[model samples]
Target chain A: MRAIWTVAIASLCAAGLATPASAQAPAQRLPSAIIMYPNILADGVFETRIEMVNLSGRTQDVKCHFLSPPTCNGTDFFIRLTPNQPISWLASRGTLGTGNFFVNAPPFNGEGSLKCFVVPDEHGIDHQNAIQGRSITFGPDGYTESIGAIGIQRLTPGEFSTTLELDGDTYAQCPDNYHFTFVASEPGDPATESELILSTCDEDLENLISKTTVVQFQIINEFEQLLSAATSVRCYDRKVLSEINSVFTRDTLGTPTGQAIVRGVQGAVIAVIVDKFVTPAGAPAVAANEPALSRGRPARIRIP
Target chain B: MSGSRLRGVAVAVALALACGTMPARAVEVDQVDWAAVLRALGIALDSWRLSPFPRMTPTPTIPVPTATPTRTHTPTRTNTPTHTATRTQTFTPTRMPTEPASGQLSFDPSTGIAPAQRLASALLIFPYVVHSGSKDTRLTLINMSNRNIGVNCFFVKDAGPVYGCLEVGFRINLTPLQPFSWFAGQGTNNPLTFTAAPPFDGVGELKCAVDPDLPDLEAHNVLQGRATVFDEDEGNTVAYGAVGFQRLSPGHFPGVVPLDGFTYDQCPERLHFQVLTRQTGSNSSIVLTPCQQDLLTQVPTSTTVQMQIVNEFEQVFSSATSFTCHSVKSFSSFSTLSRSTLGTDTAHLVLRGVHSPLIGLVIDQFQGGPDNSTHTAANDPYLEGGKPSQIIFP
Candidate 1:
């Protein structure tokens, strides 16, 4: 009788508590109305290929902005997707469609980030949560890697406003914390190194005002020994892991793997990591992974 | 004692033991092969209903205190050495051994589900893996918590005659924060070469699960992994993060684990991908594996995928294809996906398993003009609308 009761109670708990948190909130892996690609590089040797799709059953109009570093200025473009249309373009060459569907100018060079959103139409932006995108960076030596664009869906769609709220009420909130894991690069091993790219969630494209925030990092090695580091990111920034702190190197940690917990001190940020590894014979390989998002906070994206 | 009173006492004692001595107990029985025993029982009752067994069995859990404070750090302007001072603020691992250093540890205590790919405890799937003369895939796995974790992995062969679905199983112990990596051809060096079984040139999927033998720790979603495929001669490489599913329920894990958002998170119902078609002188191939598997019985499962293709002009076309356990579908094979038919260089594709859920990546190879001969890039498609599925583990 006791066993039967425990089993029965456990079954009820399993049925009631099975709904995932993602059902209530948008996840990075799913399609959304807005998407952001934080790492876009086109520096001669490497170029970025942007791909996008409309997952809805109706036509959708999308507006995109490319923000490059140093100044992090914005360049705007327009694209019209008929129902489930898909599109692709090289960041360096830009894209020109048949009619008004095109980019005004060459929107990319060096390195930066790309953000896109569904424009308000008669159908409203509510049904426009079908935009899915990816950015693939490829080099001449067959070195290529890709990152899924972070997708944000509107929680409550209303009258069109320049200020897009990512507060879990208007849209999906920005993650307050990001968990990054990587293998420590060996000291003198020209083969292994990782690059970290970070983009702030707060932006003002209408005014070209980039949000600069200080990011705090708490790192732990295989031994559970903790280390800390900090850096300031304006708009978008990229840096080698060891440049922020030498502890990321295997020689310093005395371990092959380490985990870094990152948080923005002032606001929120999204991050991606690209790793390059080569064998002893000089064969090279590269891969990219996005940090896991935990917690959530409000952020605003102001656009004209 | 009455049944209800006895049950309450059992819960209290279980929580006390879990909070106090979980790590020590995990190490004490590290050598046991409990999965093998379960595999034997699963084969004997292959057709029997096992869902009720997992829920009824009592599993110990260490309840995390509700009001754990979120840690805040001082923002620094530059990369100065003083930034390292925050290391001294480390919180000891006592109250919550499995809690990550993040702000909120939101997880289902009954099901043990974490967000997809974040705190994945149940399974990690590398949908595409290749090993041959010109190419090799390297796998990297990491443990994210403060305690050690044991993992069991399987290499399911995708190409062969009768034994195409053959599985080669192996186990490894991951120290806290440890990152393990090895070439698919070379396998792990420490435990000898545990590469793919018969037929040296093989391609398929790699699935890793938290070792069920570790008492009270079978479903802590603290593992994360990634895979990189690179060319040996040309150095062409592409990498992707492994798809992870966190365990939803904690107890005696059943052989047939349902991915019905109750026992585990549901598998994605549809996958969205965009790629450059043959019109642009580029080729794209998608490697896919079904979410439903019978590793215990070594039986393969097949699912048909319905694809909706949309060109740049908003023109839509539909097609369907079927495959067994694993398959690599090329865009050129389908007329609807070609540049000549679609009249566009690139197209957007949405794929759904007719009867089940699927996971995979799209790999694109471009032909460069001058100094560069060729290059490849790969990325995971966007997933939408999850559906219930099941995995029969060995």
Candidate 2:
């Protein structure tokens, strides 16, 4: 099949719909990238399928690791993609279950996005950002929401982590800090979870995901006062953080209005995605009369 | 939005297939190998270009034959080509996914139904009935940017005959990351009072233009949005995404900004889609939205789009119309197509604009069974976006 395509190309240049390689402008090269999907769900029957494509000219050896343990990639898998090649899988599990296909990732009970930093396979130097990806949530309710991934230029060695080699000759780098902000949610409002992914960049097993950092969180209410005791996530193996002493839910008999801050230590940064889970079963039916409650609700598309 | 980029990928497939640069079909099949055609569709999706920045589900790929086939019949079974030196070519099951006389559709992962990406210029294709019961499209536009943005939003309704005018649409300023939500057909209660913008709320797509007033013309990729469609029956709720196409800088084009509009870097000249329905048991349809040529131009531009639907038998049933900016056309119910010769199972729909470009038009199948059980499977139309650089309106 490929051989025939090659001959056809030669004939096409003579026929002319497409400009010959020499005549056409040079194609854009993929850049060194820090591709992140803010939210990945693998809870119960729900799932998050991720699709990644490599449009670069050469093969790209990219490493992927989750911020926490029993990570979705199964201890961070490395994949090599040729130009224009696309590889997709379920983030929770490395691959899909039996014929229940159509899903790239399994139902990962957790919620947070996947973070990938693009670098040359052989050479550690950052490569052009050429990889693009998208993540979709398959809620048991049957509604499919396609939230594609976003690629931000990888942080320079100076902006985030230093070029550090933790295990073997393989490289390990981490962002020094990350801050997440979202409008406050009230009680009965679908509880909101601020999931931060801090993956193991190290590629060795003897190390067994040993790098650790203190992620201190501060909850500040609309009144600008501390709502909860100063709490910190103490761990070396937590990939995603969805509970800060049940911070996602409102305390006290009434709903509270405030924001929380999670400050990571130097050489300990991660991507944060805040999901407003549609009110859970048996939760309070929201009081619809007050217009104030609707202010910070997550924005969604409608059929107009 | 990735619609233009999706179109870009589609164009590559069609071009490669057209010029014989790539496989006319990936594997030679005795019949239309639905699975083989479906798998190759994602082959050209460059990870980096998968609807850059803010688009998803690029366009319904232009089917390119992956093989210089021993047979020459089917191509909707195609996409961008991949030239591999040595590879394992899996022979998927020849039988198509099982489909009953009616009720449901269990689709393949790559069915082109993934929610599409959002862009500065987008269209939310869905069904809306606001007459006796409550059926309205609640449109939401979010300015992902932290900065305030000025947007011109239109809620167009299908009048059965033609698309209503942009006369009722409104222009509002959105605050940093603010969301402008409204109930179409039914007036919204947001920045404005109880007023439903014109093409006054029937059932159709929504068009949003960023930076309506321009010299800077800076409002192309800054907006991302979606639409929650409401149907007559209470349980009829399907979340449809608005696919995006970018607004290129005037500089991309020499003087004039040209009437047809500068074709996108990844735009395709044509597009194709597939449709299905089992008798009247399924209500299958495809909605076609027209990408604006020079959207802001007060001088209305027009283009003729020839849309044809061909069934399994190779019989053709088509419709052609000239539309200005902000108009949409829909081909409803393939099960009962205009040409009965095409039969009842599946139909191939092709959309070609004489001058402008077609967006990611859609085809959805909806129905209610004997037990009053309602099932809906709507996929973003499989669009093959292929066109010259400019999708000029006039």
Candidate 3:
């Protein structure tokens, strides 16, 4: 009976239903993309799986970097994909035990995020335009879902900058102004966190080439009132994990549903994911980010 | 006794028994037959002696006790938004949780849908429980297109009309990659519209209709976006995601199509959802919430929607008829929905809408300590074919 259903799903997957694990956005050419497993548990209870596919016309070089919060937990690995080849990984536990291990994002107690992009290197094939991917996380009491990886199109000339600089200034000049918006705090209660995903959107960097950028911030209350702060960002693909209240209340901004205006001294490509985490009962935790293009799409402007 | 003597004695006893009367003393000598019995038992005694004894009973299934419906419990998150700021984002934050843990997610903000000739529309369906002890649905909707688009939203309450269709709906416009979200309980949308709907003290669904405008002179790519839905209560928490439907329509550009070429009239031929219904002093159950998207258009009163529940043994248990638009039903072990026994097991939730194409969600959960609760929601299977439609804006 189990075999029957297993085979049924397998065949159906081949025919239709599971056709696109991530309802891929239509594109003429494959582009660089970022895949996140977001929440993972390997502490014996919950588990997370990442499915990656080379949806390009040629073989590709897949570069994956695992980022954990609290203490800048970072690791990197490479994947070689023939055209249309697919691969799956056990979050940070690596490629299912063969040990090419690289993720330590979870089981440390809470949640973490990961970023992946396809780029050519001396060791692997040249860039595969874009990689279609999905992340599934499940455990005993929570829900499991396979979500499509968010895609970051290949950066065009000046589309994204690593050093905050003037819009038309040379790469060496200081960024007139660059900041990412995030809603980290909520209202009423003060336990929920407004987590942030600070990804390095610069996919075409030199091999092992890493750079650092200074960041400043204009924290705002729910009233859109300005507050204070900032941090140093390493383009090595890392996460900025912080509580909304601590970062946005009387100590920071003023209330739960406040905003953070993250300003970079230099220009760089970055994507911010503001996830709201809460466990009113204190045991099981869940996050819900108000559906808003508040973070990913940064406004274009010139800062003095 | 000697081996020869024992055999001879056994033969004598057998002959006496066959002759007519076998003495009890004859059976007392039966112990001597142990050696012969071993030889007669034949087949691989060596292997049998080495092998672990197999148990006689089948796997013991965990029995799930029916949950005494509770009306009040601490929810993971609430919908009632406080006045943190005179003004907040479209999707406002209602409460702060117990703790703030670090987190991250690499989203494909633009990867779900492709350009299609059809005036394609995507359907975003989710379930919510807003009663005293109820759960709420928190979700995010994104517009992946570079051009402006509009979305029509509908709130389908879990109960029938006597409870008032409970559907409070409205529309919103998106500029390029705009995202909008809110808690269904307190209210969503600008004027706090959903707050006006009846108190949906039960489970129900939300449907958002993507672009309903058909293609103009120039062929254009349709809108696309990513969705994340979280089902949480103070003790229980579950989260999953569904990308907007991608239409693999056949034509010159046979790759991807939305809204089946943007055709206004469309419905899935069949839908299948795998669910886990755990029950007990330990809280487990498979929740199947099916809503008929075309309810408002029903004729002569209402339409009958039948859902057949099939267990692992191929046994089918069906539900009572559903006339109204939405229904949130639960089937677990030892419950009225079971065939014989109700323990920890898996089954398929099957049903179809008579006149309207249906949308369904399946959640499996168990209530426990420390961690409070655990649950998982599986993916929806569009077995027959994709059956979501574009919305007609009011």
**Each candidate: what lDDT?**
0.68, 0.38, 0.38
Q: Would you give me the overall lDDT of model 2?
A: 0.38
Query: For candidate 2, lDDT tens digit of each residue in B7-29?
Result: 99876675454333225554454
**In model 3, how many backbone clashes occur?**
56
**Residue by residue across B1-394, what tens digits does model 1's lDDT show?**
8999999986565445444434454446647344543444454445345555654455322121112111111111111122112211110110011111121111111112222444435678889888877888768777765567767788886665655687777777777665566678876545321222222247888888776544343335667777778787667777777887766556545656677765566777667688777755577788889988889987787889888776777666888898888898887778887878888777777788876679878888777633555767775776655677888777
Error of 3 at B50 (Å): 99
C-alpha lDDT (0 to 100) for residue A200 of candidate 3: 38
Q: How do the predictions measure up, each by TM-score? A: 0.74, 0.44, 0.45
- Top model number, DockQ: 1
lDDT of 3 at B282: 26
Candidate number that wins on lDDT, 1 or 3: 1
Candidate 3 local Cα displacement, residue B312, angstroms: 21
TM-score of 2: 0.44
Lowest lDDT sum, 10 consecutive residues, model 2 chain B, at B86-95
Judging by TM-score against the true structure, name the best candidate.
Answer: 1
For model 2, what is the alpha-carbon lDDT of residue A195?
36
The digit string of per-residue lDDT tens for model 1 on A1-304 reads 5456555655544543342222112356654778998888887778888888776665667888888888888888777776666777788887775432543335478888989988757433336466778888877556676788888865443555678887654566777777777767764545478888999988898888887899898887755678888998998998888888888888887666677778888888888888776754576667776666566777889988
